[model samples]
Target: MAGVLTGVVGALLTLLLHGAQHVVFGAGGHSFAQEVRLASPPRRLIGMTVAGAVIGLGWWQLRVRMRVIRVRDALGDPPVRLPLRSTTLDAIAQIIAVGAGASLGREGAPRQVAAAVAEVLCARLGLDDRHRRLLLGAAAGAGLAAVYNAPVAGVLFAAEVVLGTLDYIAVCAAALMSCIAVVVAWPVVGRDAVYHLGAHATAPNVWVWVVLAGPVCTVAGIGFNRLMEAARRGGPSRAIHLLPLRITAAMAAVGLVAMTLPGVTGNGKSVLEALVGRGGLPAGVLFALLVAKPLLTAACLRGGLTGGLITPSMATGGALGALVALGLGHDQGGLSMVVCAMVGAAAMLATTQHAPIMAGAFMLEVSQAPPTLWLPVALSVAGAWATPRLATGLKQL
Candidate 1:
């Protein structure tokens, strides 16, 4: 029953986000908000600046009035409870941010909302702390599963990342909840795989190149994390939170970037999808986007906009992978290029999130890649994850 309810809510949330995007951005179902061109340059600028103000205001409210309870804070031994008001506000704020073309993902919002709902239910049922945490993790994973239509990856993510343990009961519950969520969401969101790699077959000869791409992805992923941490540092410092001035400056910066490079505006999903379909973009544009996206994403994160980094990370990784493939003289539509993309994307996601298993599983599920490519993907993910620590001796990632 809990699974069903969570699943239904997750589905509804996905639909609501899509509907919001359609109305706001006229994306018409592009998860990445591709249709920024649909709106005039002036309009995009106005919309994004307004969104920044709204996001800033919302964050200010939560920081001031509500005792914000993060899932990470609550995941520890002493389970912390979530406040419904704060969670709902956060979720709604995320919706508005993403709908207005903020460079972030909606995935985290659904998970947070679902986990908050689960926390409330568990409290009402008088569940023990351990059970509460487990249920919360499961519900959160269900939301992710529903969003991507990947139940197994959802279960693994909850077990591996959320709960930080592989308890059998928790795993089973997460699995069941993920299945329920995806099943419920299937009708509305449809059952198509997220990325369609056409006529792919693994090329063992080029597997070495895929392995080499691992280090590239690792550097990119680690670079992004470091930038984000730096940005996040300013969040609590009063000097950085200079009311409208700071927010206005940040939004204006984003507006300037949007006016010049609209591709960097949203989560970069459409951009990634375009690259996937077209194989490789012109080298200049590809490199330019690669450089521009992370900086913009860092700014957004630092500027008080709330959304997930998963999609953005994936987009960046995909672009990097395509660029690498192009450099290697491989056709974009070749199996080797696809493998590079998968490995690159998985590598970045795993290293950044510290969940190689979840990243690999998610890449596999979302791309629906042939099983033959799994070994290369796994190797690339493992190498990418380890390279950062080796290079910087940074165990924090």
Candidate 2:
């Protein structure tokens, strides 16, 4: 029942996101990135500026009145209750912000709303703390599964990240909820993989690049995490009276950048699609995005905005991987850009979240990659997961 309700909520949120995007950017039948690119400079600037102002005001009011309990915090030992009104409002604000060109992932909104639904259901049924925690984690993962149609990744996310355990019982519950949510969401969200990677047989030399690029991606992922942390810590106070103005100013700066590089606007999905697609951006442009996307994301975080970093992190890794492939001259033959991008994405995701199995599963499920690519992907994930620890050990030595 919780999964069903969460699935419905996820579908509704997905519709609202698309509606908001269409209304804000006049996207019509086009993707957000294309619309932004086609829009005039002034439109891009004003759209983002207005979005910032609106979210700034909405979040300011919400924060001033009620304490917003994050999804993770709500799964505490005693099981913190997620206030329905405040949490839903926060989720809506996040969706609208992302829809209007905020450089943040849309995944967080669904997760919050789904978890809130689970919390409310658990309370009414008088579920115990243990059951409640398990349900909450499962619902959060279900939300992700609904949005992305990746049940395996959702189960792994619940087990590894939310519940912080792979206990058999918890894993079973998560898997059931995730599968249910995905099925319920199929009508609205479609069953297609989020990013399409055409057929490409895994080549022998691809393993070589994966091995060479793993440590590099690991370092980049760690650095990206650190940068986001710094941004959050250094951002403006949420309680400040002039928060709307500050956020507006920061968003306006983002708008200025978007005037030329519109791909930097949304949650990095477009960037990822371009990276793995044929005739991808030039090496110089990929490198520019490798630097620009994270900085833009960090800026949004610093502007007191809240959203997920998952897609942005993946996109960054993809760009880095493409660059590495180019550097090694793998683009000439024996390696496809798609494989490199996926490997880099998995490696980076594993490093950032510190969950190699989940990361690998996520990339595979979301891309619908062939089974043969698993070997290189797993190798990359293992290398990425170990690199940071090795670096720390070396530092200690």
Worst 10-residue lDDT window for candidate 2 reads: 328-337
The candidate 1 region of ten consecutive residues with least summed lDDT is 235-244
Model 1: per-residue Cα lDDT over 254-318, one tens digit each? 66677756677666766666665545466666677788888877777676665788878887887
Off by over 4 Å in 2: 77-79, 199-205, 236-239, 330-335, 392-397
Local distance difference test, each candidate = 0.74, 0.83
Q: What is residue 192's positional error in candidate 1, in angstroms?
A: 1.2
RMSD of each: 3.2, 2.0
Top-lDDT candidate index: 2
Predicted candidate 1, C-alpha RMSD? 3.2
Winner by TM-score: 2
lDDT of 2 by residue, 1-397 (tens): 9789878988898888888777667865456667777778888899889878988998888878878888988787474688888999989988888888888888898899999999989889999999899999999889888988899999999999889998899999999999999999889988988887754545566678789667988778879999999999866564468778777876787788888777788788888777665445678778888888899899888888888888889889888877776776665222477778788888988988888999999988887877877887899999987887888999999
